[model samples]
Target: MKTLLESMAHGCARCMYCDDSRGTDIDHFQPLKLAPLRAFTWDNHLLACSFCNSNLKRDQYPVDAAGDCLLVDPTVDDPADHLYLLLRCGEYDSYSKKGEHTIRVFGLNRPDLVRGRRDAFCLACSKPRDWHNLRQAGDAEAGRLAQALFDSPFVDVVHAMHRLDPRRAEFVVGTHTLPALEHWQSVYGG
Candidate 1:
């Protein structure tokens, strides 16, 4: 078994295997059943969650012409750039083909994940002005944001929203999602 977790940490964005339970496995990115030629090729390997590798994806490698992927590669591209977490409905919407494909392929809007992302979004939006102030203060905003994100119960929401809707970025920080804001304010020091 290759050290797929290490490879993913270096390359895959938010590589799911980074939070492995039983260590990582060498997942064939394209699926060995679909692209047997690459069954053992290093380039075809990736570190994936058992959920992503087994129950959800399996050997299903859907692609478009030029053999490009229709799904998100947490390795090659940022999932946040294309996918968004819906605050009210907890569904995912996409602004681009890549995002659409990823959402469909990975079931990014699955009810459990949707709920989780919405909670994460709530945490992100609860303290919007602080983020703005941090930005104005020139205080390594990226690091602050990253820390705030993990600390927030709604951090997953921020990541999911960033993935689905970079174009209408305000949804993550808008007032329409006030329930999340209230929750954060009451519990998370917002």
Candidate 2:
């Protein structure tokens, strides 16, 4: 299994699936049953989440007329290039057929999930004092903020972002966690 740091750093950024929390199950981007030749290729391998790996995306490899996979592999390409996050509606808009399929398949705009993300973004923005003080505290202050987020119930949002968008999550967590990293035991895995 890929380490948390590795998953967060590479997997999340790449939007590749990684069932690190579960077992080390290597999945083909396109199912081996469907595309036997590409099955063993390194480009076809993706680390998947348990929900995506087992329940939803199991053996469901859709291909194009040329027999190429239709699914958007975040590792190879940027979903944002085709998909746009509708912050107001919490849905996704896409210009490509593959992007549309991916959003629908993954429920990228699930209402509750979208609302949760919006709320988290607002929360991070609302605390001006925390942010202002963070700059003055430097490393010591960053540790404190990290600790505060770790202990807070609101941290679930932070954790989810860590999995979904590591770069954004890391930025949020790093910026917010200033002055206190110890309090954020909820993240940083202690």
Candidate 3:
């Protein structure tokens, strides 16, 4: 079960919530305490880091006034629809109550996570250039670099870069890196 959950996770089995640390816990998306009947349900399981599973979100589920769960379920919900990442600073801005709740419950804006995301943003910006150069030079390591880029922590940053509009992406990632990013997106379908 753990192996299956890990396989389902993104970027070397990174935590589904934080996306910065290895997923070490089988998180009950709907906590077992809150929904004991769903204890053994397959869809309830999510890969999470210790900090996110134990320290942060442990059994704490919030609901809207209408009794809808406020947390963003990564399996069923697209987080990008609710939370937007600021490419410049690695901070997340929530456009919905669910996003706001998830950010608070998961500590998405914690100092360490923010720093990690910022660093990852820089790496995501630079890796495309490196990959392009390596490919042009016919370097054997180009494939490895491409794989590493996909497997790196904070893969959300990479995907966000790809999702940026033409002018904004070019402005943020720079002209040279934008084409490479687009090439990677075309090839890798991120």
**Highest TM-score scorer:** 3
Quick one: best lDDT, which candidate?
3
Error of 1 at 66 (Å): 4.3
Query: Higher-TM-score candidate among 2 and 3?
Result: 3
Residue 70 of model 3 has an lDDT of: 97
Q: Per-residue lDDT for 1-190 in model 1, tens only? A: 4564554343223435222123245568787777789876766777666676687677777788888887766667776677655665667688778888777766676776767655655556655455545555767773556465655443445544434343444454565544444433433443
| Alpha carbon lDDT at 147, candidate 2 | 51
The TM-score values for the models, in the order shown, are: 0.60, 0.57, 0.93
Rank order by TM-score, top first? Answer: 3, 1, 2
lDDT by residue (tens digit), candidate 2, 1-190: 3454235433222224321133245567677777799864766666555566666677876667997656778667766566655433444578687777776665556665567556654554434236345645664675565455444433334444333444453355455543232233233443
TM-score of 1: 0.60
Weakest 10 consecutive residues of candidate 1 by summed lDDT: 14-23
Better of 1 and 3 by TM-score: 3
TM value for model 2: 0.57
Model 1 score (lDDT): 0.58
Q: After best superposition, candidate 1 residue 126: deviation in angstroms?
A: 3.6
Residue 103 shift from truth in candidate 2, angstroms? 0.7
